[model samples]
Target chain A: MTSDRLAPQRVPIALGDRSYEILIGSGLLSLDGAWAGLPASADALIVTNTTVAPLYGAALAERLQARHRRVLTVALPDGEVHKDWTTLNRIFDALLEAGCDRKTVLYALGGGVVGDMTGFAAACYMRGVPFVQLPTTLLAQVDSSVGGKTAINHPLGKNMIGAFYQPARVLCDLDLLSTLPRRELSAGLAEIIKYGPIADPAFLDWLEASLDDLLALDVAALSHAVRRSCEIKAWVVGQDEREAGLRAILNFGHTFGHAIEAGLGYGAWLHGEAVGCGMVLAAELSARLGLIDRALVDRLRALIARAGLPVQAPRLGIHRWLELMRVDKKAEGGEIRFVLLDGLGRATMRPAPDALVAEAIEAHTAPS
Target chain B: MTSDRLAPQRVPIALGDRSYEILIGSGLLSLDGAWAGLPASADALIVTNTTVAPLYGAALAERLQARHRRVLTVALPDGEVHKDWTTLNRIFDALLEAGCDRKTVLYALGGGVVGDMTGFAAACYMRGVPFVQLPTTLLAQVDSSVGGKTAINHPLGKNMIGAFYQPARVLCDLDLLSTLPRRELSAGLAEIIKYGPIADPAFLDWLEASLDDLLALDVAALSHAVRRSCEIKAWVVGQDEREAGLRAILNFGHTFGHAIEAGLGYGAWLHGEAVGCGMVLAAELSARLGLIDRALVDRLRALIARAGLPVQAPRLGIHRWLELMRVDKKAEGGEIRFVLLDGLGRATMRPAPDALVAEAIEAHTAPS
Candidate 1:
């Protein structure tokens, strides 16, 4: 066991009356002290999935059982595509059979899929049970774990059904990423890179320089990236946890990326893969609008390509893209809002014309 | 239409951190101004049940349409038994098909069942969307509407699955209750009587005295009961919205009542009816503990009986009662926490021994 001297830190997300904390650190899974911050009770259910159970479920259950008199674990099928109401109902069924109560705390262990499912389950279980996020994937650690966005993908649209439920604590154990596949690690980096253009320019520079070290899986590089990304997300989430205003900036590439994910079907493309390509397209769109220099857009695309991510959108055609983007959560009335870059680090939401979007799609699919 | 000036008043639930308002009155739903308080640029989905759609869904959609560019309504199956993940998914499916955005506001228009399902749906939709409660039942008006306890019943338990997502505005339309069935009206009174012993003693006495007028559906008496009950609930919820400490007092009869509801099966008895009987049993448990005068327990039973609710425990037998009670949300670490009265209007939670609980059940159900 690692030394327990390093204390976990909590980032307070201020939503006026709905503020909560995002706990950040490693080895948090073994800490009973972290559980104290949750709603005081002994009855809790740890909602994980098949992929995460072998790695962390037993240890987590043991820790919870040490502190709590009765601890139960419910493992579901693991996959991004499996994050749906039918899968969520399995959790409800377990909770009901266990006679779980309002005070019961649900621990979400695994990557984004498990965390998303657990948060959604907690949000609906008995109306709502307090849940803590034990994010085990890099994507979950740097991005999904911090924001209160919890949801399941609909067949028609990815993340179409969901809620903004802030977890009581977000336990990000960097050690968990040791087992993550290489593709997943790269996917998680896409979101880490996203925080740069959308919020912090300095972080972007750091990421650009540390790309090799991060890919090499250096602990310091990974920690710095994860911490900085969390800080940016924490600040944005704190300002607009419900995405009423500033939070929209976090979706810099998500509008286009979600369409790609939905267009190809949920599991066909990893979320971060689509996001990486979508960010490049969004930068191109920004350059066309004269919001950013074309050189900078090329540089952004080059970096994404160097990192082994796609820089061009899938060949869905412009019309399908328009239809898909229309169903985005960012769409208002009938108008679709796009979060475009104002500069290297600043992004703003604006409505774009159909002709420009069509041209961008044509360019994206025009043989690279 | 009644004067728009007579819109519902907001009662701010003043928790140090998660404080919010409970909007009470009539015609509040018809006002477009209320929608402005929600998150910007999001679509709006109104979730009502079959019973409430024809009554007020269109009016609500019309009001929201004035401020929102897109507003959609989904009507779910009515009744407590139907409030599950399956029905909840119907709203999720509709939102996805309609391309509802992340900022979409879900309006819950109905009684507790509608409010719970809509709130839970909102909590899960896009992770969560801002939701407002348009409570239309007497019971919901005073109790469920004010508290953010959103959930659906499981086959094994009454409110086995749920979340604690607060509504942006709880629009209590008293006029809608006029169409509620007489049985529902009577069932609601059981909760009305709950406020007295848990928090306010004078309120209990007032309820006992005004029982006839309230039962007769006198508008003034109904208004007073609804308003006062909300006040008590708002105060309790304000202190502990998640039932941490002060809110446990509000569950004076819920521990045993939930068991009865689950044992008899959900929808078999109106929630209020089971609660009424459970209150009698809780009072008896209090007497067994020598915590309260037996006469007061009998008085509590009489009041519940006069309100046309069952006061005697059903013949599910002691073993079944224990099994059901074990599943109560109040049970922590496998120990039953009973909210027993020290006196009429004063309650506290303590672990009751199963032997004593069995003895109390025998005392309450023995042929006498």
Candidate 2:
């Protein structure tokens, strides 16, 4: 008797001794085999948020219960802003109260907020516990859920506090995205578009052609996009798991993007939205430096616009942008490193002159 | 011209990919070349405590300034209870205000409290940044400094929040021990005694003979003890960087010791004080189970007593002990796994019978 259930794809992040796998696909959340890799007889803690609990908490409990004798769930307020120490303590309290052990596996079951917070909690719980990611948003599915970058944002900077903790398994269910709002969908597409330019030009061209289909919630288009993005992320992470060298390329538009996010106040702009606009600015910067033609920059901006994402920065005022960007992680000793594109698929980290960066910011923020 | 400075010993941890070196000796705090392995052009943030800043902070700052163009330091309150999110944010604030970037390196300059907090802060700063350990206390230099177990205490449990973040370099300066109080000296020796049973039997025998000399501040005896303990810890951490198996051996006395610390309230008992008493109880429990001869337990207790360490539990009451132990990381599904000695130089994890554990607790708390 053969079953028709699709097998989960496990993408191994090779950090040598510190390496782990990212388990991708739908319905894996309900599999006991997923918990088999964890310590035997260990207690399990499901960390979800208010928005995710109503949607999938019961089902997750049922799945974990089949393998583990005891299980507990803690749900926190859902939002990027809530991913701070205050919200993180709720998990600490629940684990301490429930007598959760070092071997306890913390299952993160939400978007980037839940995943990052859960990962940080796991990193700190008992000085670290076994944790698995059950990411439930399109943006998390394609990006945040794969890498080991777990953090809580500080008021001064985005993701200013966190750890490079690799999850034992990252269970990404594509079906969960069916409930995501339209704006979130567009925001997620920004990351999906990102993978193409930094790693695969062909993927970028395919994304441009299938932008409408993906926006319409076409399953095949979405799956392909998610798979390709994960593959690129896995390969990059495998080579530079700790963000040493090659990994900087993966942050193609993130330098400017993080600055934008911090300038707007976290949660004001979705991570992907900031990244989308940042990618356009990077392209313009690349053109100004004569690395890529100005026509290519227009093409990149047009694709971003067609996908319903902002191709320009919001009116944050240039001074605020410079102040925010100066604290960005990508900046080094007063020099801002921009991940500028060499062509459609290739990118490099270049030190942009302050005057040119200011000019790009001015152009992008101008009306129309 | 030949300088009179002695070269620091680099103890190599042998795990193939996750291998690291532990530098031991005095004056390592003044070596900027110690940070050569970290990413280039990275800004640095030094996380310390109030007590250590006045002692070694200026010297460390001068050395770091010679290496990195920008270096910032944040001094936190000294104590175990303050090793929480509130204190962690102080470092985050300095990093943000100093405009620290992702590649920033954090230097932990103090005792165990400062090292653990600094390593944890580095683990969370920008999702992760490289950190170096400049352990300035006998307890830190001999024990906490070598291992990567970084954490903060939760109200409900000690070390309930933390991470296993490794440092790029560990500089354990023996000269710093000159300033450590005599009470703290005995507290640090408890961890030194721990190394013998778990990994080195000869070391245990040697420690028993040299206990008085070590207490008398015999430099040769103390240096040998510190070096051996670091070698064992580094080996275990190297073998199981994530505590999969071999690394758990390092926690032989920690499972029970942590409970005692939390039961009495964090900071109420010095970590080594609790561990010294916990090891005696663990040996007794082992003897009760026929895992070791009664003479082994008696010898262990005698050695602890000679070192001026507690061999009995404080008056926390049995009910509180049970409650705190239940929340221990070694616990799984209400069954606590105690690390008991099989012999004078061997330890193993087993689920202790409640009756035996209760009896042991009763005996430890008896008036005598």
Candidate 3:
């Protein structure tokens, strides 16, 4: 690969006043520019997880020490199960114990769970403080960390408690992804695939052509995939920060996906894995509703399975599936709204009849 | 009192798109205008304490039923002690159980404790939902409800976890104040007394003359007091929604006040009572620093005492006091910053020497 292909790329999130940049590159943790122009404060708190801390925590603290008088670290237990009030409170305790002020900056240094809890902590601590995201996992770097959607899951639903508070900046160091597990890499690829169907058909074509290279951790291919995914997400979030309308399209598969996560309980399935399977179900529902053809559903399901994601739906009972989807944030007045593909490269949110939804679920379910 | 004085006075908070009006009147809970034009939603949740639910819950539920298909009430155990994660979660449980959607509107139907927690719950649930403040106590009607400052106390400090989320509107029903305990009226008068020293001397002068009428719960005097307090707060918050610079002046006694609340444990002293005493100590510090003379300090202290608020500060050891102030949101880099008066009707935030702060504490503190 050319050196230029490995160089850092910057994507700007165009939110007025809260606008910030997502810097995607290799070896950003060591770069001085990544640490420059951050909020000037006496203290900086690094919030990460047990899984990712040992790998990169010390390096991040060393770089931050130059910018802040005190740099403290709080490594929470890894996994989505810990993404609750008890774990979130740990971040608050760390900040208050350290006497971190409102101006103190928080660095979120793990995957989605770490980024989420850290961001929510920053959002609530002293009513709000500046925070930067150092997203390491592919799913986080490509999707979750780029958007300002920060939250912790409640027992009833995933991401039920959160805020639309943007980060000061997002540093996506591709180098950190090197240590990520093989399954997580595939899980993250699911999100990259999602962008293609919902927003860009050309990107979908590229993904089909380059899926193997991306799977092999090809630097050039991974760079294009991440940059493109962030650009689409940043563009969508810019238009709808609070998910008033256009933003709903970003959750093309999340309605079913969140159901899987909540029904089986979070941590049983990685978020991206569930989203991957959920996308298949959503595409099926779209076809059943005549929004798209059956051919499109088959094509999407094939790609998800090829990417090492499950296309077969879980055996959550029909009534249970319907119940869980009803609590999805997109649901309104007890009606489950799915983000259906209007056509390839576009999406719309609407409700389908229960029988139709049940058929879609039944069509995709694995024989139990 | 004239009938015109009973008419609702609307004090608009100009926070761009988030702005809303604060309706100050005698019988606002029963008024049609108070419940009109709220966010059209399928559900409305009235979050109040046990104390308020018995009194105003049915009245509010009746008014809200006209606008919402589902009107749900969640009565939390009363008191500041319940302002924690457990209490905030009860609101979420009710919302999720009742299938409250993103468009759901929350009505905070009590005093500062209820307003703070309900506003925070709105700021969090499903990212954010609209909430209206039905502030019943004088303290909430005059200060807490108008500023968009919502929080729950952390174990380490008071209001340590929260958000700067504004309400859709604030309804200050003076009729509700008739049931307020004699001590609670004086507690609220402390906040009213605060606006004079920090922003308007004329209002302070008017308060001095009308203190008796307010103490007696005179409707005309109470209406004017609530309306004026809201207007001044609205003006300050409009300029600085977040407490960056100018907004710090609004916490003239809060640094000391928060220390007292946290030092004694939060429910020990009513928030306004602690603030009432905090103002006395803050004034003493200002005087010792030569910002104001001893006479001004004595004048303010006498007013607080006459209002039935304690002028003598709680004796939380001097070291513990400093430690608590250091954790205040205003503190930066472990240095305690106090909002001190430059002269009558104006305030500035600055750090005082430990000796001077200790001396001020000694002068006003109750003898152990």
Candidate 4:
């Protein structure tokens, strides 16, 4: 609630009683306000990935200790490869072994992979328990952390198995992103850039102008980027929590992005990286469909490349790409549905002709 | 819609948009009305257990063919033992391999295990697809099928992992119960008897009078029993879909029932049998707490025994039972909450002293 320019920014996601606030600021993790109002529990389990555990697991657990009588931490193996039933079971096993009840609160303390698995574990553990999101990566902070879309990847598809379970709160501590690898930082930017073209043209302009500051982990720029991204996502999710319509627009690049992640095997490229590359191809398709002009398509592609995302998709072969996209959750009746840009700042879900889709893939496929 | 006394009866579960109807009658599976209004999908997957698949899988698939362009059937390993992540994953594999879209409809064509697993599969597949319940067992028709409580058993507890995803519709075809084995039939009767003490004293009187007719598979007796059970369950669930309060009453025997199943290793005893024994213990505990008289406890015990269910609880050791009940979803903050009968036709969730619970167990324990 602080209005100080340097204070943490709070963006509330309106989901009725399930509604929660996202706190974005530098070092918010150590602040009491960040932990306030979360569902109280006798036991709190911190579900984080191995990569982020050593860095902040203890610190996060320390803050939670003040709220919960007993605080436990389980560090899952790092990466998208482990986002499966096996990895998910580990969380369940920990909760059960510790005798954690439905009242136990789970804290997802890593990037998208950790957040997704933890959220899903919370959703299924004893038919769901409350959970909080402590997103440490840029992509998670801006996109995955805001929406209630929690899932683990199946062998056939990325995020093929999951639930629409919302977290109790999300704390996107900007200071945590200081440790993010250069590659992952750019990947996070890809999602930050996604919000601009699909929902806010002005935000897209802001991202383009502030990409450098974000890359440098500048606190103010990171705060604005994370807060604005959450606001846009929150607005869309509020309208369609189940993705029956408006919420699907938030997945503008995900259909293509998922195909790439699945086709290459998950963890080959980070999820954000895949989405970044996929956004380029999605823009190409939008241009070919005459939904958006070529100039806009090139503009999106240029921004994606400048953000250090690959503009060229891996050569998965045209048929494989089509086959993969058809299996994307967006597809209906076996027909692949793409979230195409109707114009700058507006998105729509529709099917493109296979020939045209193939052409778009061919236009952007990396050479053999 | 038919007014004929012999016609199918519909009990609509009022869960807003997620609301669906339970059609109970003779030969409901073959009737077009039962299949009508279900979400249309290009592909339909019939998930059944090996035992039920041979008897009803093809017939159910055939009925669904009229609605779906393609019909697929998967026969899982039979029994509660198979309701685990591995068996659940088989459903996901079938959907992914068939290239099923999010719009695909899954039909659960077996008993409680099949229905629970299928509903859970539908809930998780591509983040949920519509599923219809063709519950064949009496326990399933009256309890599991009516409420949307779908789950798979974990090694630590019964139904430890699951979701509260409702089915598109539930078909409790009374004719299917004709082939049900005597033990399972008895098991199913346990759930039907459950509705009486917790919600309707009159229904309990009717069950006591009609137990023989229900056991003999008298169409009229079975129809009335199944319909009343669904009505009571639907009423309870409609008010508390997430078991925040009233819905926990439906799990009257389940807390102790689950302990028996887990103690014996899931498949050693049928879920309903365990519940039957558990109800006797629950009633004993209720009597010990003076919530109900010894006469009422004996009345419920005698009915459960006459229905061919075990009234004597298994020797799991009192401490083990206490430990298992603490992990039950109803338990909060490590305190075990039992759904006890305050009086005939009234259920209340309250914590009882450990001494009383142990005494209740001691009173009902079978000779080792």
Candidate 5:
């Protein structure tokens, strides 16, 4: 609404009283005035990883200083491997050591790993506290940072222990993505592409055409990509905040995606890459179930490859895939529930027969 | 209202779709029908403690197994001393080791420590899972189990880390009180006495009249005590489930009570014992603030003493008391917020003058 082209794009997620907004734009991390809308908090804890903190922590802290009483920065070790109980406790230790009370606000200022851990920390710090998501990666900006799914990985599974806690606000600075590595961008593109088959067909088509610009870090294309992905996720989260029914659809390929993450040991593959490959397996299973046609599967596969994501999943043994999938949060009664596309822009959750899923996995696994 | 006095009293906590009922009465633990309303799940995780498991774990498991395909029992170490992240993680470890899926139900079968840890475990397990409160201690039956404030103690504070996760149902069996040590019974009396000044003055009179029968575990007197306490707590929780405002009133004595526990190194003073003494201090503060008369404070003190609870707060030095209280869950923005009495049966939260609190502490500190 602010006709200033330099102004951020704002998307609202309506959850009644607990609603929040996702602000997408360029150079938000440096915009001091952008934080004016945050809840009146006396102190702020800026949580980021080693890599992102050195790059953006000071800038974000400087901007937040105008609003918060005190701004403290704690840079956790960089990457998904460090997302565990030990790392999570460090945040608690810092907050307690600093005498931050229940009303303190936490700022998550890095990628998905940092975002997820910070959000969970905020959720549990004093039973619950407010948090802001200042996501610095495409994957976090478009996916993890938007949904309010906060968790730390357990040795048995990824995000096995977590909370369905929402953030007070999400500031997605598209400029942050400019510093991201090429592979991580591709990884993020997988999540952006996720919106198409699950909720927005037009976004899917736009992604098909804008893949090159987005990969090249074109600002306009990247902004639109992050904006549209957030819109889809916001709508899904708004309707089903707790993933009771419709919300599970937004987790289109996450069930299989999580298995891949766990099977390979967390952080072996970036979350978005596992999801990218997971999406392919889901589409193939949908095709096998006669839920979707071969052309649609091929369309998704082609776009996935064009976006520089893995079109073929790892050759995890059938039993291993089954074992990992059974451990998913989406699962119920020991049955692995999956979100399958009824058609483009439509998703449904149901238990696919193990036999059919195994067949699809065998066909999709990369040849040894 | 089943005329068969043996039938349990059912109190419903109306949280719309997430609403649940609390069933209270004698010998309900042995009744097969008591667990019929629990969510239909293939597996159930019975989380008890070393103390309570020997007495009631097998009986509860037998009834649950009739409805669940598998019943797994995990008895954590007994006592408040074991209520920490280490013990809380044990519940998670057991759930994962059992391959318990999201649909699995958890039964917390013990006192306040077991119920708090188990409910928190359910809240964090795979984002969240359903749990039932099988409170065996009178303290839990009348207080912690009825409300959804589940948490474990942080070394820095009591109940510093946890979630407000409601259980599917709470079953309070008065029969279990038969085995309670006299000291534990007195600990529970503190919680019973709490409802008097904070919410129900009439209940205080009732407790005064029935203290002798209640101490002897008279079935009728015990049933009434549990039923009315749950009613008061349920009404409070129904209005303010998350302690946004009105709920803070429930912690009238807790600000100091928690300090007492943390100062004494948890388990040294039973939670209710700490609160018993805390209520006396809060009442004295109320009288000093001109909200209530001297007689009110004396009445509360006499009842607390008659219940065999400590009426004197540990001096712990004025600075130490303030330091411990600053870390309380109810504290916000680094200010120690205490739940104080506006008058009998009415509560308000505010900060007491440090000098006034210091004077009260000096007056109440037991000779050492």
Candidate 6:
């Protein structure tokens, strides 16, 4: 249990027939042995970004080629800005060009953006096909890669166009995070910290203790963080696979987070960074609603600031924030819905009154 | 059932939670009563093509407006050529432009092209939303609008990029097909002829007997055909929704049909036209495999020809036909698979040897 170098840990996502595992550890890309008996498709396509392909493209393809009759790779342009329909169609172009059939299995080999677009491509490719997530970035391994929410960004809203398409399996290689930038590493921590306020307070405390090791790229810390996050996500999704009810709790800060991303434009702030600030805003809103105390908000803000994520949100203004938040997919009947903490480690969905929403936005916005 | 005008007949597609009904009758659209309690979304969006919108847009909007808080319309350019990412995104653009939320319900109001694009749009819009199929064309009412297989075409293939998303309800108003052009009526008949070879031999006999009445757009004939086709489709999809096993039978001629559509360019021939010709090719292939006799092939050819669908297929060279069909989503392990008839009524999927496929193609091509 203590030894962590290259030892793969499997976390099963219990989704009945759609269930698969999240394999977390080091050197998973080169471990051809794990590739056995899982999705024995004759054809395989690996979708990655420009930054990731050159690093491990050949090795990944080589591993897949050992078992598959054919392996094709499509490297997309990097970053959140490219998560649009045009860029998404490029993967479709490659799949169609390769004459890959429905039996073809897609491997998404980058961060959340890559995993999302590839999962979506698999979902729509011939109506439905199987895909695996080889999420390289920590943000993906902990959050996006675990859940089946695959989407490309719409001009008006982030992730506004997508589907809840589950992957065949998820392989989270801890070694991949070694080369991730410090800023991205902190970004991933935002997601790790989110699990605490909404579902598990104990996980939040462990994250506080291990943030330093995770930021330093310690394999055990990274592995534990990814595995625990996936376990929580799997449990949540298993109960409500389609965000029917319980699943919305997992999107604790996502409503505010999505507004920020859409407001400032997608790439201006990293997704996890927006969510970090978003969680603070949600906590503030919770405090305003008399659900959680100010102390909890203060503690959350402190942990976020300490983790190198932004504690204060951007000044999108009350009106603009209201407008952008209304565009959220979670919103219904012109009412902006939010997932707020009932108390530390528990969440509930409710539509905040317009006045209170404005007040919360004002409280979160930094003085400029 | 006896009284023809405005007598509503419902065909329930039992898909567990995602299940919905297909309401077939005359004046179903204008009957505001039928629209009630369906998709009770605050926001309703009607996605129709330029051609069909002018005919019934105002009436449809009026019916939806009575129930919905807000009603919006996005009219795409008509035709199979427009059923791609560009046209599909126009719906998204309007959805975002209107600040429509997740609870918004979309109404697909046109042929298979419109129904398919709208369904896919509904599937991906905010990860999913409720949608109703108000199919105007015969092809859509009989086939595409029922099964929940929604897709947009890629440059390389028809229905290449899509999803398996069901609609909240399907309203096939027999009146909508009255104004349908003769060519499109024949196109719709292609899908009707498909049900016989795959599941129901009696439905085939009935279709053959009433071909003239259907071609003439008789209200009773149209109503019966739409209901029977949907009933067959519903039964098949209920057994196998995602084309895992039993659902493949629904794609009787689609493997070859898709190649025809892809090879000639998506809009060059109507989808039904391709399927009509493809059915002939499949029957010939079926005879080659000894799964069905020459009499059955001749019977299918006569019915397809009398229904005004193409009995002769395009002379795609053996190399080209092989290349194209291999790209079909149905193909597996580099082998071209076909849904061949086990007898007059039952269908089974198997890979026909390449030589037999080539020979069948040669047999079906015109003498010239």
Q: Which candidate number has the best TM-score?
A: 3
Ranking under DockQ, best-scoring first? 3, 6, 2, 4, 5, 1
> What range of 10 consecutive residues in model 5 chain B has the weakest lDDT sum?
B1-10
Question: Distance from true position, residue B199, model 2, in Å?
Answer: 4.2
lDDT tens per residue, model 4, A82-195:
889898999999998887877889999998889999999999988889999988988888877766888998887667898989899888888888788999999889888998
lDDT of 2 by residue, B9-94 (tens): 67776655445677776556666555557555557777888898898788888878877888788899988768877887888888
Q: Each predicted model: what fraction of the native A–B Cα contacts (within 8 Å) does it retain?
A: 0.89, 1.00, 0.89, 0.68, 0.64, 0.96
Q: Could you tell me which residue pairs clash in candidate 2?
A: A124-B162, A162-B124
Output per-candidate TM-scores for chain A, rounded to 2 decimals. Answer: 0.90, 0.91, 0.94, 0.92, 0.92, 0.93
Pick the lDDT winner: 3
Record all residue pairs in model 4 with backbone atoms less than 3 Å apart, i.e. clashing. Answer: none
Model 2 chain B: ten consecutive residues of lowest lDDT: B1-10
Positional deviation of B8 in candidate 6, in angstroms? 2.7
Docking class of 2: medium
Tens digits of per-residue lDDT for model 6, B168-209:
888888887777888888988999889988889898889889
Please provide, for model 2 over A1-368, each residue's C-alpha lDDT reduced to its tens digit, 9 standing for 90 to 100. Answer: 01224566666667654566666655566666655666554588999999989999999988888767788999999887787888889999998887776778888999988999999888888877778888888889888866688888788866778887878777777667778888899899998898887889899889988988888876667767887888898888777777778888888778788888877877788888999999998888888888988887888889988888898788887677777777676676667788888876888988988888878877788685
For each candidate in the order shown, give its overall lDDT on alpha carbons: 0.79, 0.79, 0.89, 0.87, 0.85, 0.87
Off by over 4 Å in 6: A1-3, A251-269, A281-290, A293-298, A312-339, A349-368, B1-3, B251-274, B277-301, B310-339, B348-368
TM-scores across all candidates? Answer: 0.84, 0.86, 0.91, 0.90, 0.91, 0.89
What range of 10 consecutive residues in model 3 chain A has the weakest lDDT sum?
A1-10
Candidate 4, residue A232: lDDT: 90
Candidate 1 reference-contact recovery: 0.89
Model 4 chain A scores worst on lDDT over the 10 consecutive residues at A1-10
Per-residue lDDT of candidate 5, residues B211-315 (tens digit)? 988887887888888888889988988888777788777777778898898898877898889999999888888888888988998899998999999998886
Give the distance in Å from residue B323's predicted Cα in candidate 3 to where it truly belongs: 6.7
For every prediction, compared with the true complex, DockQ reads 0.56, 0.73, 0.81, 0.69, 0.67, 0.80
Kindly report which residue stretches of model 3 are placed more than 4 angstroms away from their true locations once superposed.
Answer: A1-5, A256-269, A284-299, A312-336, A353-368, B1-5, B255-269, B284-289, B293-295, B312-336, B351-368
